[model samples]
Target: MDEFSFCDKSLSYEVRVKDLIDRMTLDEKAGQIGDTALGVPRIGLPKYEWWSEALHGVSDVGQAGNHVTHFDDVIPGATSFPTVILTSATFNQSLWKKIGQAVSTEARAMYNLGHAGLTFWSPNINVVRDPRWGRALETPGEDPFVAGRYAVNYVRGLQDVEGSTEDDEVADLDSRPLKVSACCKHYAAYDVDNWLGVDRYHFDAIVTEQDMMETFQRPFEMCVKEGDVSSVMCSYNKINGIPACADPRLLKDTIRGEWNLRGYIVSDCDSIDVMLDAQKWLNDEPYYCLDLDCGYYYPNYANTSVRMGKVKEAELDSALKNLYNVLMRLGFFDGSPKYEKLGKSDICSHENIELATEAARQGIVLLKNANQTLPLKSNKIKTIAVVGPHANATSAMIGNYAGVPCRFTSPIDGFSKYGKVKYETGCGEVFCKNESLIFPAVRAAKKADATVLVVGLDLTVEAESLDRTDLLLPGYQQQLIQQVSSQSKGPVILVIMSAGGVDISFAKDDPNIQSIIWAGYPGEEGGHAIADIVFGKANPGGRLPLTWFYTNYTDMLPLTSMRLRPIESLDYPGRTYKFYDGPTVYPFGFGLSYTNFTYKLVSSTKTVNVKLNKFQHCRDLNYTEGSYKPPCPAILIEDLKSSCGDYKVKLEIEVKNVGERDGSDVVMVYWSPPQGIAEAPIVDLVGFERVFVGGGGGSVKVGFELDVCKSLGLVDFRGYRLLPSGGGKFVIGDGVLSLPLQINFRR
Candidate 1:
């Protein structure tokens, strides 16, 4: 096998993969179809496992033996970071990339120890369309732009080549070797896990073309085109009456053909079995003859399908080439890895663990700080009360898709550092079902100088296979919070730890509850991060990635409705911050800081002109005319793509810290369609940046350059991106600052 051309290190990956496939028999090639790829021992190839997970860290949840394990002399764990939902709340893309880099470093170290695989399926780029969806904790947020940006940054960090360009050009990506293969997944409109009577295995997501292109598929496309991810896992559910794995339009045409994905497509674990039993997609004589009547392994079905002419061997070769390409990039066939010496020292280094704590600090949002209630003066507040279900929580701090951590700092442990801490489980657990337990908690709060109520949902109330029925707190939790706050001797500070948004309107309105913090399942150092914000050790700047809706939202809208636009006749109010115009407990991008910041537009382009060819319809229309002339026709942005040369909108805004405390501020810029455009969102986030400013009138300038077609256009009902000829506004930082802009066509 060493004499074969496939073993030549100098050959291109495509050439090597083709040479290897040509040497394999049909059955041998078929053996490579499953998650556990059975390698040909005769050719010196080793078995490869493709099911390892690295969502936020090197997790132990995959079927492959790729997991962090405790041993006598080896490292006991990996650095577990905060969940994706909380990390996205930071609005700091650089930090997201850094976390991904750290995770991949540990993953490579594990691989050297024979405990991990090269391909890590992770950074779930699915948009959290519905807050109640059980897996919301695993997603970026509701906005396609945010999800797309996260996919690009995180995937780049995970699979970074030593000398690759930051732009990730296709040529450079194809020629380079990857540190680790990163996959952006559960591809194409997969949010619901289990809701009411519908389960993910059987549910058919009837998505409209507009929503599919504009919202659902946008992130996956960016993951492929921009991130150059090595793999994409098809979802379990069906999209528009077709199983995602079997749909040629999604897996073949869109992902590979349109976006030019340089990776293989994988199933979402036993999805073939789901297709056979749950979906019942294959019900014929040939399928029945393949040993379904008896007990036949599911992976062997691929072998039978090729012989039955259901799938061609040439197609299998193509898929194998894609898979082998990633393996080659990871140096699996290059004799030995350069970093084979990486081991225990690199697994949970001090720097990695510190980054986890910093991530928790940056992502914890300060929801309310009425009359300067937070930053409890340590000198004055001698005795503090930390009461609630999560005050002493350890495992609950780290959300799902996690590995064991190096250490833990519970809320009680963190607050004890500042002053005397009197702790109590407010009502037995987060459910707060036992009314008897409330009395002891109230007594603890009454004696302390300040009270910190740590309460909210957890994995039991909302997780995989569990969709929340209502947005309110669990049983008696609200009662426990209200009672404890009323009896407390001093100001009450509320700390909520959960993946999904909760209505908590009662606490927001209560004057006794002086401050509120939303720490969305912060990682192992969550307690320390929460304590940092409460005592002014760290200033909170994380914004809400998903909207905090009122209870009436779930009452009016069903979880199954996959619509982004409002239906006036049906009284449907829509979804996400993009299209939703209804009332919210707290809107998207809402958060408070210890210090306040104000924005001033330094410079910006007033208008952008798209030079059009002679065949364009809108080229002759008068775009400058007022109400007298007919409105210029909407033009498809795709047609103008070729003509968009150096046409972009550049803006520079100065941010001034107005308060007397140093803090970080997220500058979010949102773009709105022309006033009269039908079915347009209220506003869409186009660009954002998180900046740190010092106390006492410190200021800095933030710059942004946006492509006209990519950032300013809106998707129409027919799934076409259109740029309307009218006036629009660019809102900055919660509508505090605004700038007018226009788009016009020139022949």
Candidate 2:
């Protein structure tokens, strides 16, 4: 092996991968296609497992069973941060990266102990297009910009070398050794798992090219181009008529050719099987060059296809090169890792545990704090009642795709730290179908100084393959909350512990329900985090990443309608905060902090001039008569591609904490395109930054620089990005503050 150039650590990954591919036989190349790679042992290449999961922690949920062990003597468990939806609520990119770093650290440590694999299929960056889609818990919510930013930061933290800067250039990624490999998964308009009679495997997502470019495909584009991710897992669903795994337009043309993805394309677990058996995509196409992540028949099929002249050996070599390149980047063939010293001690270290707690604290959204009824003084509140199925939750606190946590702190345990506690499961479970259980919960609430009703959906209510039918609380859970709140001795605090948004407008309008908190599967120390917020130990700053729509909204809207723009003639309200104009239970970016904060626009660019080239077609169009109005013709962004770099919008906003307590506030910037553009969003989030401001009179200045083409541009019906020539407004945080601007196109 030492005589082989592939064994040399100093050689480039490309050269080394090519050498290794040249040495391997046809059978050996086919064997390396699946998740369980059958290495060329004769050439000193050992077998490797390419499948593992680290969504929020070192999880053992992948095809490689128990890869990240918990029962082991040396390492007990990994630090589990809050699930992606909750984490995204924090609106903190730095925190997202930090959590990613912590998870990868434990992953590398586990790898050193030979307890885990280097490649982890994680950070599911699929936008949560619908609330009923069960896996919303795993995504960064409904915004494409947020999801894209999450992919970039989390991927960088997972793949970059331990000491490398977070802002490392994409050009440098190819040469650098990876700490661990991270894959952005379930690509290309894949949000559904199972809905009514339709499941992800069989359902075909009929999406318009405009909606695809504007929303569905934006995150994956960012994941590939900006994140520089090592791998992308095609979804089980079909985009239009073609299965995602088998679609060359998506996998080859878009991801590789256009985005220039410097990585391998792998199918979701058993997605190849789904395509062949369920979708019958293989029978019609008879293509055998697709990449498989996990399946039994790949090697045999590949060997058969190569002999039958169906697939070229060179094409097989090309795919193998990609697979081996990833392994090479992970230092698989380069001997022991540089951080080989990392072991059991690094798995659940104190710092990692603390980070988990902090993550939960930051992501807990305070939906309602009516009349400042929260922050129950521990001294005044002598006896508190912790009632609900999730009151003493153990595994429920950690949503799906979770591993063994380092420890657990139930809601009962957390509130007990402040005062004497009385506990009762309001319902036997989150299902809460039985009315008899509510009596005991109401009795306990009546006897306590304050009642914390920890009620909401669980995995049983919403999880993989379990799409919800309604947006309301399951069964009798809503009744229990109402009963307890109406009869409680003191203020009743409602705590929702689920992934998808609940239409809790009943409780929102109820005076009896003083406060409400959405703790979306806050991992491990979640209970403690919720208690801290309730007791004023931590200020709640998390905003809703996705809008909480009314129950009636789902009644009219079909989950299959992938269009994002509202169709007035059809009365289709559309999807997400970007387009939907209907009433909402809670709008996106809605969260109440313990204190108040105000935003003031300090400075901003009033006009952006896009100088078009001489040969462009749009430059010949006449300008409109009115001031700040668009021209007679629309200007496609492709025509002014070269001039995009010349125009940018820069602004500084001062956020002052006007309340009596210090707290964190997210400064969100939204853009409303020129009014005349057809099918444009109402307003969409462009940039956001979370900052901590001290008590009364304290202020923090936040700055943002947005490209005119990428940030302010509108996607037209033809799927082309168009720079509309007219006046627009940059809305800052909840539409209270805004700056008007004009975009002009000239030759």
Candidate 3:
């Protein structure tokens, strides 16, 4: 076999790529488009390795001593990373990139030692909408800007630079430059996907043009334009009346045409086949047995209504090509040797475990604190009751896509190292239908000095392809909290670790619940990390990645609505916080810290005027309010309109950490038209920056750029882009438009 790095050569390398493509038969080419199962041995090609899962680690098959990993609910010792939503809360781009690199590195080690290359797909880029949807943890929360920013860094970490230097972190490499190709999944308008068992195939969500672009579509654009994702996994539901796989406007025009994405597009495993069967059984129209291209049909249901054309051949070809081209780029056709057998030698190393511990520490979010009742100073606080199913379960700490962890520490194991610790399994394994333990759990709380109730959704309860039936934790989880808070003798700390958001309504109003921490499935070292935060060994800095809801499932739009609604009706689907006009239990990008931080609107118009001062003498035109739009530099062809020149948007912001301890804060900028511009949604995310503030005070400026103005042009209800419309305003804390700007449009 020959060793070749895809990065080594240029178009000259395309010769080899072309040669491989030419040698492959049509079946092989098609096979390249659709990934195969974990163990399928084809003649010329390596066995299909389609089981790579990537949240914390590869969720696919990894081997132990001499045996291959099996599909069991519980793997003895697996390291878990915080959920995607929770990690997003950190707003750490560097960490996201590192996660991508690390996940791929470990995956490569497994592949080198005889595991498959097929990865469990991850970084679900779906905008968090309707907290009730249950799978919110899989997303990067509700803001498109945040999701997009994280996507770019994550993709860069997972994928190798087509032509760049080698990373010292990744040990083994022959010629392959890319660690792994990350796929931006569930493309456009796929937030909920919460419906049970095959029902999502027929679910169509109707959204307004404004909501679609502002909320759902914005993230996909970021993933394509900035992230440079290598592949995309189509959603199960339809947008408007068409399946995502067959939607030409989304798959061809927007993703490929407007965004210029060059990656392969794969169906969500059997998603194509499922929809095909749905077109046969669900719709009253006649059924034709056609391939993905919808050509060469065989009649299935004849008598009643026999319409032949449902899916177009062109659509099928486009989808297939989308997937095939990506494989060609991956060198899947180079006839390489399959990986060999792996052993415990490839298990969690000391260094990797340390990295995992640090990651857990950085990802924890401290949501609330009243009198700074944390960081227990004395061992006199002895009676500590660790309640809730999550308190003692080793598996609860790590969320989905876990690796076999070398060390397993539960909250019970961790807290016990300090003083006396009492344990109660509050709820069963995250998803059991039982709820009788509330009274007993509360009774145990009554006997303690302080209580740490670890709770949240079980991995089995919510995940990709599986939608949750309810928003609140099932059984007596919430009731149990209410009961315990009402009866507990001491202060309470609530810790949650689901892949999705939990309704904190019960704990929010209760004065007894002193603090709330969102631990988002912090991997193997999660328990130890939680204990550290509780005991003041580590400071919690994570924030909320998505919004929280106050009520039941029906209060929000169904995930299937994208497939069921009409295209024109979609403009106002009210999916994300951007479009949702109603009040929320919690807003997007909202989170609390133990220490206090102050935000001040410092300056406005000074910076904009200063920038325009240089352009005053330009010969382009007079600098009148009607003709003073910002000009883009010639060098930045596509990125020209990134900043705003309108006099309306010149505002300055300053932040100060007034508390005694050091802490970090994410400044989120949400903008919306004042009124009557284009019937805009409530608000849209424009920009955000994360900064660390020391004990005294620190300040930074978050300016609104012109490109933000141009990008906000997705809402054109009247057909023509508004030349002179409503101006954008800045949001700080719970305050809206502490500093407002005016729009100065050019004629």
Which is the leading candidate under TM-score? Answer: 2
Model 1 lDDT per residue over 1-747, tens place: 768888998788888989999999889887776777778999887787777788988887766443322222465778889999899999999999999889888888888877778888897988888878878888888899999999999998898854555565666456467888888888778988888888999989999888998999999988998888888888889888878877888878888789887777777777767876789875531222110111123357656777888767777787788888888888888833566777888877889888988999999999989999888899899999999999998989888988777788889999999999999897788888888888889999999999999999899988888898889898888988999999999999999999889999999999989999999989888898899889999999999999999988888877888888887788888899998888899999999999889899999989877666766665222233343332455677777777655788999999999999999999999998777566778899999999999989999999999888788877777777777776788999889989999776666
lDDT of each candidate versus the true structure: 0.83, 0.85, 0.60
- Evaluate model 3: give its TM-score: 0.78
The alpha-carbon lDDT assigned to residue 591 of candidate 2 equals: 94
Residue-level lDDT of model 2, residues 146-262, one tens digit each, is: 999999989988987766664666564565577888999888899777788889999999988888888888999998888889889888998888888888888888888899877
lDDT of 1: 0.83
Better of 1 and 3 by lDDT: 1
Global CA lDDT computed for model 3: 0.60
- Give the residue spans of candidate 1 off by over 4 A: 64-73, 168-172, 284-298, 335-338, 619-631
Mark the regions of model 3 whose C-alpha exceeds 4 Å error after superposition. 1-11, 25-32, 37-51, 61-79, 118-120, 161-177, 192-198, 281-351, 429-443, 552-575, 581-583, 601-653, 697-706, 709-714, 718-726
Q: Could you tell me every candidate's TM-score relative to the true structure?
A: 0.95, 0.97, 0.78
Who wins the lDDT comparison? 2
Q: How many residue pairs clash in each candidate?
A: 0, 0, 43
lDDT for 107 (candidate 3):
56
